[model samples]
Target: MERVGLYPGTFDPVTMGHLDIIGRGMKLVDRLIIGVAVSEAKRPLFLLEERIEMMKEECGKLEGPGRAKVEVLPFDTLLMHFAESVGANVIVRGLRAVSDFEYEFQMTAMNEALNREIETVFLMADVRHQAVASRLVKEIARFGGDITSFVTPTVKERLLEKYRK
Candidate 1:
């Protein structure tokens, strides 16, 4: 059976760190569905379509026509429901800090309870992205800080445009 995984994130503005995780997760699963979740409580910097578009634009750069499979999707309801919709049994997440581990652990436990068949896998961020996060990037950018080195060139460009507007 082919393995399929769901990678869920607010994405706010999908970062290079996200791409790194997606790149690594692709190797572990036959296909990866990257879901840009819309949260009511957390108003994202970028809308769902914007987030998805940025992710697609960056992911399109990965080489080897078929080295890995990817899809940019969206979910406003439960993540497990979305994962089930696509027949995904695994959830891919990236962990950068200890706080992240705690939150992801709780989320994993909840997801497992919600769907016994689904498993959430946590992958550590690449060394370069270990410190890059959407919140941090936005924080820096909001204050007129340079974030060009934090995210992909495309992300940097989009962020600048967002702030410029």
Candidate 2:
């Protein structure tokens, strides 16, 4: 049976770390859906449409023998519902540090409770990207700091434009 994986995130701007996780996760699944969260819980620098487009453009560049069917979709409802809707039995996530573990553990436990069939898989961020994060990147960019190293070119340009304006 073909395995479909769900990688959900706010992805206010897709970071190199996010791409790293996606690339590694693709090899483990037949299809990988990049679910962009449209939650109002956190203020975002880029609009939902822009983020989705950015993710699509970045994910589009992944091509190889281990490439999975990549799709970027927006979701506002429950993550479990979104995963089920996309027919994803595996949920992919990235761990940047031990600070992220507590929250991720809680989320994974809750998600498993909500749907036993859905499994959460964790991938550690690459050493080079260990300190990269969307919030931190945004804070740096908002203060006129260069973020070219943190995100993809598309995302970097968008961040610069957004912060400049």
Clashing residue pairs for model 2: none
Worst 10 residues of 1 by lDDT: 59-68
lDDT value, residue 54 of candidate 1: 89
Q: Which stretches of candidate 2 lie over 4 Å from their true place?
A: none
Give every collision pair in model 1.
none
Candidate 2 lDDT by residue in tens digits, 52-161 = 99999998898578689899999998999999999999999999999999999999999999999999999999999999999999999889888888997778888888
The candidate scoring highest on lDDT is 2
TM-score of 2: 0.97
Whole-model lDDT, candidate 2?
0.92
After superposing candidate 1, which stretches have Cα over 4 Å from the reference?
63-66
Q: Cα miss at 139, model 2 (Å)? A: 1.2
lDDT of each: 0.86, 0.92
Cα lDDT of model 1 by residue, 27-98, tens digit: 888888988888758888888788889888877776344546888888898888999999998999999989
